[model samples]
Every structure is written in structure tokens, then in C-alpha cells.
Target: MVTAPFNWRPHSRGRIADDGHGSAVGPQQAVDVEAARAARRRLVIDRSCRVPCLVLFCSAVVWLLAGTLLAMIASFKLHEPRFLADFAPLTFGRIRPAHLNVVAYGWAFNAALASLLWIKCRLAATPLRGGALVLAGAGLWNVGVLLGTLAILTGRGHSTAWLEFPVPAAAMLYGGFALVAIAAVLSLAARRVRRLYVSQWYLLGALLWFPWCFTVAFILLMPAPVGGVTESAIGGWYTRNLIGLWFSAVGVAIIYYLLPKLTGRPLYSHQLALLGFWALAVCYPWTGMRHLIAGPLPAWAITVSIAASVMLLIPLLAVTLNFHKTIRGRYRLVGPSPTLRFIVFAAVCYLLVGGQGVLLALRSVNEVFSLTHTIIGHAHLGMYGFFTMAMFGAMYYIIPRLTGREWASVGLIRIHFWCVGLGLALMVGVLTAGGIIQGLELNRAAAPLGHYIDEHGLSEGVGAFLSQLQVRGGAVDFLDVTRGTIPWLELRTLSGMMLLAGHIAFAVLVGLNVAGHSPPRPGPMLLSAAGRGRPLE
Candidate 1:
């Protein structure tokens, strides 16, 4: 006797029962019809944001290629300082910093922005209101990156590690970021959905935190300092928190969004997620002091930092358990979903990197290893292994939807994964070993510092030996200890080459997919068990 709503349509099987006068759709059929319409509306909202996202991604991939080349040059220059020493711009000192800045600002930040914008729109269930603003913001960001990179190469760098952009360039970058952040804020405010998802919390947190960290770091490191030791303390704080608050926040947001969707399950525990978020916010900001453990900061500051670093385990374990439970029986999805595979890999790296941070913060360990290449290995683990991999996974999932086509070649995807994975492992493993050798040798009281310079006479070998001994740490036989790092450095260079090739393949694949080379398909472009066949999801 009751009729379904006016917009209701019968699902398959013509299940609607007819009253004596007219056909009436069932209640379940009406619900299904509404759900289907909602999904289509969401798709439309996402498509509306596609153009700006594409511009950001395209620019990001170009920067990725450039950064990998610079990394290769810097890695090789470590062992062979004169390899390109003739060119001032390509020298190890200049090229190394340039590589770091380009990858972080140009590639990683831009990539994160693209992913953030798309995901935010999806979760808010709203179309982007200011598409032109997003595109213009991306354009200005690229301009700032270009100007900063050129300044660094031209020897006008700020001399800070990640904040090396000159003042003018930094101003430009800050302005660009403000515009992008505003777009995110407006989109979130105008959300049609009432409840905020976990991913939205992370996206908002990162967008807010990055500018705060950047501005604080700039004030502390750029202009005149309060004191020499205070400057160092602030710089260390900014550097450490930048990785945790900005990069890790964005990376984890992507994982949260993709994992549930990929596994066809909701998050395991909302309370656990809330716990993780609050714990990280309260604990991660102060943990930066751990980086200055052996430096001239107050003991209380160092102790607080170390404690915060160790306490991070609470959130780390909480998030790790939440994700594991969500993906409990869906391991097979890793094969069919590149997004799941990369997110899982990034999750594992998060555990490794966080545990490593706790270990490296202890005074007993810090005394010997603080100055060694171990620090370099750890930095890469967080930046490249964890954050970058998460972004790559997000891109794989997002691009196909935006382009309305599958990937160009499944084979290239496998190649890119293995290349980046194996290369990062090799580089990290080798550097860790070399750092241990250098640390143990440098702490040996049997050999004095003066003896190294007196015997070796400031030649290239002697310079390397003394440099390691003086800062990074060395042993009784300075030459022997310094020589131990050479093989590792060479291996690192080889790994960098692998990374370069992998990035090139990724760029080409992205370009092809965007250009509509791949035939349109309903399901995802996924590799099979053997990692060669195309298996639809």
C-alpha cells in the first residue's frame, strides 16, 4: 500500500510490488538508488579538482627527476670530491643542499599538496569552489621552487640545511603555501558531510603545522641569533619537527584514506586513531631536541627531547595496531592494489624509523654515532623510504581515477617499485655499517687527533680521515677507518643511479597514463602474483 519516494528506481529483477493500481518500488531499492546517486555525485566532485591536481603532479614529477640526478651527483662526489669540482655549482657542498631542498619543497611538498587537495574534496563530499585559486597557487609554488633552487646553485643559499632558500625566495614560498592552505580551509569549511574523517584531521594538521614550523625555523636560523648555542638548538628543533609534523602527517593521512578503501573495511578502532593523533601532536614537537643531544643545549632540554622521542612509541604502536587489524585478512589485496602495497611498506618503515629514533637518542649511542653517516641513513629512512613511498602509492591510486584510464604498463610499475625498494635498502644498509665502523674507531683513545694530521699531512686521504675523526668519528688508524667508508659511499652512488632510472620510468609512465595511452577500464591496473600480468580489481 505504501509507495517508495518519487526519485526511487527499481533495481534489477523488477522487484517492485504493484499495488492494485500502480507499481511501487521496495524500500531497499529506494535506498540503493540514493546510494548510487551519492557515489556519482562524489565522482563528479573529484573530477572537478582534477586539473589543478594534475598540474601539481606534473610539476612534481619533473622535480623528482631533477632531484634524483642531483642526488646521484652528490653521492658520487662524496667518494670522488673532484668528479665535478671544476663547476662551482656542482660541487658537493652546493649540490648536496640543493638536492635536499628540491626534493623536499619541489617534489615532496607539491606531491603532497596534490594528494591532499583531491582526498580532502572526496572526504568532504563537495566540489572544489575555487579551482582557479588552486591552479594559481601551484604555479606560484613552482616559481618559488625554481627561484630557490637557482639561488642555491648560484652560491646565494641561506646555509641552513632544509631552510637554505634565500630570503626573497623563502618569502615567495611562504606566500604560495598560504594560498594553497586557504583553499584547503575553504573546501573543508564548505563540506557537505557533517562528520570529519580521520584523514581530514591529518590533512588539516599538516597544512597548519608546516607554515608554523617553517616560520619558526626561518626566524631562528635566518636572521641574527639570540646566541650561538641557542641558534643551534632552534635549528635542530625545527629540522626534527619538520619531518615529524609536516611530512609524516601528510604521509599517514594518505595511508589512512587508502587502507580502509583498499581493504573494504572500516578502521579498526576510532578511539585508537584519536589516541594516536593526540599523542603525536603533544609529543612529536618537542622531540626535535633529541637531535642536539650532545650539543651545548641545557640538560633539561635534551632530557625532555629524549623522553619525548621515546614516548612516541605510544602513538606509533597505536597506529601500527590499527592498520594491521584493518588489513588483517586482506594481504592478497597487496598484489592487486599498488596503493595498499606502498602504504603497507610505508607503515613498516614508520616502525623501523621510529624505533631507530629511540635507539639513536640515548646518550651512550649518541656519543659515538651522532656525527656518523648513521644520521644520514636515518634521515633517508624517514624522508624517502616512508614519506615518499606513501605519496607514490597515493599518486598511483589518484591518477588513474583523474585520467579515466589505466596505467600504461604494469611492467613499469613493478620495475619502479623494485628499483626504489632495493635501492633504498642497499643504501641504508651500507651506510649503517660504515657509520658503526667510523664511530667505534673515532672513540678510540689510543690514537690522538694531532697524530692523524701530523702523519697524513693534509692530503686528500688525510683530509677525509681527519674529517671523519674530527666530526663524524674515527679510530686508531685514521686511514684504515676512513677507508672503510669508501666502499659504502661507492655502493650508495650505485643505489642513487638505480633511483635515477626508477624515477625516469615513473615519470614516463605517469606521462603516458595522463596522455590517454592506456585503454579505459572499469577496474584498476594491477599486477598479478608473478608481478607481470594485468589483473583487474
Candidate 2:
């Protein structure tokens, strides 16, 4: 019998076969583990290498389409609130948070869990029980999202943005998550194969990371963790922590899985990966305070936050260096492997987003950039640019492996990648431009000082000051302002409109194209099929 290259135990082996041997031992008194391992591994390999992965793939596409629609509607709202103003339930405010939640929780997290669950079973030599339960759990989550989206649009939103889903919807979501998590854990516990792998680290982390973050977010935000003025800071920290711990873990885990798969290599330095993981865990909670820079929060709070944010460079660099080194010389394989392309895109964005995050923490820049589209722009860089991209890569790689077939069509993958990538890139461009312009306007201290602003001129002092200054500067004074040149909010809004249009087109194309393709037949051993769909010729 063949043994796996990686050292591991198979989760369980058949109990009956050895009876034929007729040894001194009774039929069940003792069984050979190695024999059992082989049998269990074969069973898992045979079944999992079927339709389950395909189901996961289709589900991801559906959720992503949902997310894009939300993003597109929200983008329009940013520029023209009237687009859906007549429909209170479909207003940009409601749809926007819904879109973020759908993408982050629905599309990304679901895809991550599905991929990890499948991969974990394969690696651990375990088998997923009740694939039906997996499906039911996924279905329930989507249903909850539908209800939550509707609730938010109808003004049931708590206005917590990411956490806007009402109590019932939240409870439903938690139930679904619980079902899936329990299945995954049980699958691991029952796995016929016993050795854990690199991917399992991510799978395990994801299962744990989300519950921790989500529980905290709900405890703090939904119930109001504290009744005082300090609640906002806790809420902000909770939000950032969710993104940092849960969403961020999902994105990086995909990178860890796909990058190595594409190259047909082991990770260059497992040691470096450990460093990155540990550092992120230690640093993220504190970095949350950076969002509160110069707010009513204490000085030390902000100081420690800034310090940790700066130190975030460690994990960021660690991942970058690890991936860059491991994938070296495998660039040729990328064209052949959709997995490579998707992960490569994600890794690049990770570097860019991490750098942008640190820069935002600087007080001078925050003074100008905090309240405007700049913040949104940076947030998306991490959310879409890095997180979404990574999730996409995982889906591409996982789909074929799970389904035991090639993608429905490579053309579809390419279209999805470019549309989502370019769409988000455009989003960043417009939002960033708008943010810079608005910040520059705010920091137009040449008019005066000690001024505070929100994303819009919302507050009374800020509003009155902004109005008074407009009269003083007239239109001509706008040209000669200082602070690093980012675009103004007006311009940013226009740019967002354009990006929004692109994302809409991308979403439509993805939906239409995916719908057009028929499914493929299953096969064995799920060869990495590592490439964009072309051979070496």
C-alpha cells in the first residue's frame, strides 16, 4: 500500500477485513492501524473527490454576485443618494452595509470555510459527515443574509454597518456557523487520516478566529458592552478586530494554501510563517485604537495603538517575503494555474494595503484623511483589494479539487478576476482621490486652524466653520492648499461612481457567464491542474 508523502495517521480504518487472517487475536481484539489508515484514506479520497467541491464553488459565485450588487448600489448612493431614495428599504445607506456584510461574511467567509473544511478533511485523512448538514448550514446562512439585508434596507439596521443584521438574523447566522464549525471539528476528530498540514493551521485558525471575534463584536455592539460614552471606542475596536482577526485570517490562509500549490513546492520557510501568524495575533487588538486617533480616548490608548500599527510591518513583511521567495521562478506556472494568479494578486495587495494602513495611523495624515473617502479607500484596499482577492484565489483552487473536475470554464475565472480586481482598483482610485481632495480642503489651514471634520461636514462647529471659510476663500482660494495631495471628496465621489459602474458590469458578467456554463464530470486524485488553463506549449 502507498503511504502519503506527509507523515500522518489515517483517521479510521475498516474494522472487519483482518478477520480473514485468522491470527491468534480475535476478530476485533486488536486491529492493525496501518491497514485501517489505508482503508479510511481511500474512502475519503474516493468520495470527497466528487461533487462536494463543485457545490462549494457555485455557492461562492452566488454570494459574490450578491456582494457586488450591494457594492454597486452603495457606490451610486455615495455620489447620488437619490438613486434609491424613493425606496427607503433599498437606500444606499442600507444597501451599502448590506453589501459589505454580504461580501465579507457571506461570500468570503463561506468560501473560506468550505475550502478549509474540504482541505482539512483531505489533509487529516478524515471524512466530512453529513455533507447534507454542510449544505443545510450554508443554506441557512444565506437565508439569514437575505433576511438581514431586507431588514437593514427597511431601516431595521442598527447602523453599526458591519453588524447591522438584526437580532434574529444574527442568531440564525450564529446557528449556521455553529453547525458548520461543529461539523468541521467532528470531521477532524473522525478523520481517517491523522496528520495535520499547513492548510490545516489556517482551517483551525479560521474556525476559532471568527467565533472569538464575532462573539466579541456581538457582545460589545449588539447589546452595548458599556452604557457610557466610551462605548463607541469599544465598538470601533470590535469592528477593527473582526476585520483584523476573522477576515484577515481567511485571506492569508488562502494565500498559504494556493501559493504553494501552484508552484508544487513546500513553503520555503515554515519558520517565517509562524512569526507572521503570532505577530498578527499579538498586534491586531491594539491597532484598533489607531482608528480613535486624537479622539476622546486617552493619550496612552492612542499611543499604544499607533505603536502596534507601525509594528504591523513585521507580519506584513513576513508573509510577503515568504510568498515571494516560495513562488520565485514559478511565474511561468501562474498562467497555467488560476490558483497562482488569484493568490499572486492577493499577496501583492497585502503589501500595498498593509503599507497604506500604517501610513493612515500617522497623526499628520489622519488629521487630513480620517473623515473622508480616504478612510473608505484604505478600508477597501484591505477588504476588497487584499481580503476579497485572497478569497477568490481560494475558490478557484478549491473548486476543481473538490469537484474532481476542471472549472466550468477558464474564461469565467479570468473575467471574474479582472472585473473584481479592476473594479476594486477603480474603487480605491476614486475613493482615495475623493478623500485626498476632501482632506486637503479640510486641512486648508491656510484659512484657519483647530478645525475638526467628519467624513462630511456633519457637526455644527465643523459645518459653520466650513461654510464661513467657503465665503472667505471664494472659489479662487481653493487652488493653493497644502498637505499631501489626495483628491477632494467631490472628485472622490465621481471616481466612486465610475468604479461602481465597473463593479456592476463585472458582477453582471460573472453572473451571466457562470449561468451559461454546464457542469463537468468528476475524476480522481484532483491533480493540481495548476495553471490558468493553458498547457506549457
Candidate with maximal TM-score: 1
Best by lDDT: 1
The lDDT per prediction is 0.79, 0.64
Using alpha carbons, what is the TM-score of model 1?
0.87
TM-score to true structure, per model: 0.87, 0.78
**lDDT, candidate 1, 1-537, per-residue tens:** 122232213332111111111121223445475556655765687688889889899999999998998899899988987797899989888888899999999999899999998888777767776788888888888999999999999999987678889888888888888888888888888886655667788889998888998888786677644657777777788788788988998988888877766665556777888899989999999887887788888899999998898899988888888888877777777876777777888888988998888899888888878888888998888998899999889999888878888888878888888898888888888888778667767674345434555676646535555456536332467676676678889998898888777798899889998888877857666676543332222
RMSD over all Cα atoms, model 2:
9.5
> Candidate 1 regions off by >4 Å?
1-31, 223-227, 445-477, 529-537
Tens digit per residue, CA lDDT, model 2, 93-179:
677788877776677767766766766665555567667767777777778877887787788876665788888888788888887
Candidate 1 weakest ten by summed lDDT: 13-22
